[model samples]
Target chain A: METKIRQLSSNLDPRYFQIVVLSALLLYGVAILDFGIRWQNAIAIMLTAQFVQLVGTRAVQLPRFDPLSPLITSLSLTLLLRTDDVRLAILAACIAIGSKFVLRVRNKHIFNPANFALVSMMLLSDHAWVSSGQWGSAAIGAFALACLGFIVLTRAKRAETTLAFLGCYAALVFGRALWLGDPLGIPLHQLQNGALLIFAFFMISDPRTTPNTAAGRILFAALVTAVAGTIQFIYFQPNGPILALILCAPLVPVIDSLLKGRNYRWEQPKGVL
Target chain B: MRILATIAAAALTVAISATAQAFCGFYVAKADTSLFNKASQVVLVRDKDRTVITMANDFEGEVEDFAVVIPVPTKIEREQINVGDRAIVQHLDAYTSPRLVEYHDADPCMDYRHFEMSMDSAAPQAAVLEEARKVARSRGVTIEASYTVGEYDILILSANESSGLVSWLQDNDYKLPKGAERVVDSYLKQDMRFFVAKVNLKEQSKLGYQYLRPLQVAYESNKFMLPIRLGTLNADGKQELYVYALTRTGRVETTNYRTVKLPSNVNVPEFVEGEFADFYRAMFDKQVEAENERAVFLEYAWDMAWCDPCAADPLSAQELRELGVFWTGGRGGSKIAPMPAQDVFVTRLHVRYDGEHFPEDLMFQETGDRQNYQGRYVIQHPWKGEPSCDISQYQAQVRERQEQEAQQLANMTGWDIDDIRKKIPFPEGDAPVQEPWWKRIWG
Candidate 1:
């Protein structure tokens, strides 16, 4: 049964699985959890992201337009980016798709598309914010389970990044609590955040934007954790992981150059290292 | 269309009772901070990096026994600390409290144009100086500044270590709670200064004030948070904290913990109007339980210019400034002005927490969401006047509404449904006709 399931799964692109999982989470958030996400904004983001992806493909003269990448990005933005203005939502979609085509280093994107758009929208206007704490503990528990299933379905090809980032983040949070003489519940509550889970499993674990080597990815995770801990603990700011990711994006190419490994392609379905 | 007619009829009948009602509903009762024992109220007025914090001292004991040790982000100087008027804080509380409002259902028999009407409805510290500094310095503690503001003697202390600070406070007869040493050390490690205030009985007696006024501090820092860890050190099982944030942009919410908006705009049984305080406490306890006791609840978030029901006309510009809203122009505007103030948004957050559930300080961020919200429960009085036409359907609908309200009350407050049903008068007669179970199942 396992062999047959793997055989069936190997034929499909992992992006399809990610898309399904993200859509399911988005549905749960909207319908059951009352995440206060506007349907019009979600629709606008989906359409705008796909349209921008099409335009970028035509401009770059690619063989064909693949809607999966933009669809995943749109679902991510719909799940994370919050704004009262529909125009801002459209702008987020445009920036997310447009960055993939424009910002390149060594034929690879510098930053994760959704991370770039979320951080940019936050800096651009006060209207947009990420409701990191909107997901209660029960929702976080369910989402963590879904993320674990996602790693299984994808065959753990790029699971190293998520694991390394989560491990380092938990260490830092717990370490801080220990030093402060606080109870274990403090760090546990911090780790149970849905936004943090999404960042680890979706944003930071994006193989396309991460380093091409395992050693490089681990080093990258450490750096992001250091910066995130500073922002959260020292400066007492919200959206630490997102802000840290954008800040650390420029260093990925440097890591790629130093470590020297084969680049990842979603269709390859091979080991990351 | 039929539902609309029934609602109109309910409203018309409500007019016969001759009690005032408004768009939000007629003001009945409120669940203010006083509802809970050991409830602490803090007002934060913030814009950009500037923050003015007024800590209300609800310390219920001898003035000499009242002492507060708060962890502040920046060092506070003598000029930065002031004694605030207690009345302003009370006014702010009344303005942002969760309110219960009632509406009258109109007569189903009479045809009247639907209309709207509205009506307006409605701590101490002491300490000593100089020689105390000598004792503090011996304990590796630096007394940043000291001031006698009104009836309170305030001190700003920065310590090299938590043990030294705790010991220094203890030596000075400041009665530090157990497990506070570690918390102080943590704050010191994080580069936070301590604001300590105690009542000066000599000065307090000279001032002839019966109660201790709130202590206000103005500073510039990026950390927008309330230090609740030390408060949790007390033996109290749980502490209630109400934080009223006055900001320029929009609603303020917690970053680390989920900020859930209290259930609002809900229709409830009319009996709730009399026991609003009990109803609110029960509903809040249930909400806290529902969120696993780790959530901060938003009770009210609205523009300070006006209110739909005008709980107590918006605070005047003078009152706003007294609470440290520095950007509201200059001087007092006309007291008779219809609109009292603007450009200030107030957000009321209530948190019932303890050390076990909340380990870290309460951190906040001001969002651009200007959407207005309030903890408003509605009680629509059923029309009791005689009807000129056949009104069995109206009565049936009213009965259904009453049952739904009872269920809603039960669900929200975790009250027994039977007890709720007992409390509700429930429109008389026109019981919902029950279909035969066998025929229905067969069909």
Candidate 2:
């Protein structure tokens, strides 16, 4: 019985776990937190993403079609993106999946699909925005726990990006507090935000889009954090990390070329790929 | 795309307490904001980067003792400062305040029709000059600009350090609150300038105004936020703030903290009309607690063109222009299209905050959502005259509704359920009556 359980855990891909967790969070948000996500829009995003992914697979002639990636993207987009028009939601789904095929370098997508779609939608239409404070601080504790569990479940593979990003971000916030002579409570309150957590844990920490080497990932994390801090404090804008990730995505391939390392694949075991 | 932002009907809570007859029902009393002590009101008109802010205070003390220090995002010159009319702010309060409405039930034996009636309810000294200047200069404080605008003397100050600013304020007889040094230092590091105002008694007498009017300032910056940190430095237990945000787009909400809509459109007992002020206070207290006292409550968000059951008439273009809405064509400026041309969206946000839960200042962002939301509560009056035919079913349903209203009131206000039920005048006939439990067993 123990060996059978071990076999299931060992052979199962981490994306399945990600899909379950993201879906669960989505359920919690829509059901309990009043995220204000419309049901029709959620359906359109999911279906449009899947349809685009299928067409992209056929056009590229990949070995096998995988629906999990698009499902994950759809869930992330629904969780982050807000718009009154269903057509815009559908358009966002198409752009998200389409970017994975068109914007590739060294056989890896440069930007996280959801991040690309969100930025594109914001630039393309004025009706779309990200409600960063919708998740309120009351749910931060439970959310942090879920994210920590996710890190443990993934065996900490490429977890350096999440750690480094959060560490650098916290240092910058606290440093600002000290410089301003403000109370510690101010920065503490700022840090306890759900949107920032979502960005740190799920969006920026995508192993496929991050650098291949551990050292390269840390460097990339610092770069993104610096840009994000500038945008938020200097420019006085919201969703700094989200906008920063898209701006910094193109540098991943450059970093990978400079510091040579093995590429990441979901199916392959460590040291084999 | 012309997006019509209409809120869910279920969430329709309108708060118009002023005595105005509009909509389908007769207007009644409203929840007066005077129930809150230490309350401050601010009107912000924002478009892109240019912002005009009007700060109003109800200082009920000797006019000579009134003074205020506000942190501004940019340097203000004389043209950027203006004294606003107090009546306009009062009118805005009446226009956007959460309202109570009454719906009289039609005769069940006769033709049935719904009826609703809407009703609405509605600083400091200064210091010396040349000797103060040397001290201020030594303390790294720069009096950037000084102007006398309509019964008040205003000084714009920039400081190199917080200590200098604090000492300068103290030397000038402005009592600095404890722990204000830290807050002042924080603002200085951010490169924010201070707008200091004190009543000019001679100018006040010349202007023939008894009470102090609000202070207005206009500046251009990317920061769409209010500095409440310095206000929190005082030992006041809690402060109530009403922010009336006028924007060109849809609604404006706090980006840093959660902005939750206040409960609206719920039916309550008939007695709520008398003590709506109390009911509003209790309901607001309950909501603040529910959100853990860390949220900004959105009381009203509507287009300025018109209102269905308006608490008061929408502000005219002339009035809106006075409140710093620069988009509208001003007096004699080719009076163009009348209604849609006044593209001003007003959002009313109320918060009871202190230094603890609300550690940081409020940060806001304008969204594309144009949904009109209001904090409106409803009450229904039962038929009083003699019925022409049998109305047994109607009375039973009315009793059930009364019970529901009782439970809802108790749930929202944390009031005792039995006490609420005792107050409710439940229907007399055809209502279910409780029987002794012993009868069921013994009989």
- TM-scores for chain A over all candidates: 0.93, 0.92
lDDT of 2 by residue, A73-150 (tens): 999899999888899999999999999999999899999999999999988987788888877776565466446535
State candidate 1's DockQ.
0.64
**Candidate 1 local distance difference test against the native:** 0.75
Specify the poorest-scoring 10-residue window by lDDT in model 2 chain B: B21-30
DockQ of 2: 0.75
Candidate 1, residues B288-398: lDDT per residue as tens digits? Answer: 998889889998899999876645567788778878899997356643553478899999898877778887788899987889998877788888888999886777678
Against the native complex, each candidate's DockQ, computed on alpha carbons, is 0.64, 0.75
Off by over 4 Å in 2: A1-6, A139-149, A152-156, A261-273, B1-37, B107-137, B332-341, B429-443
Q: Residue A247, candidate 2: how far off, in angstroms?
A: 0.6
lDDT of each: 0.75, 0.74
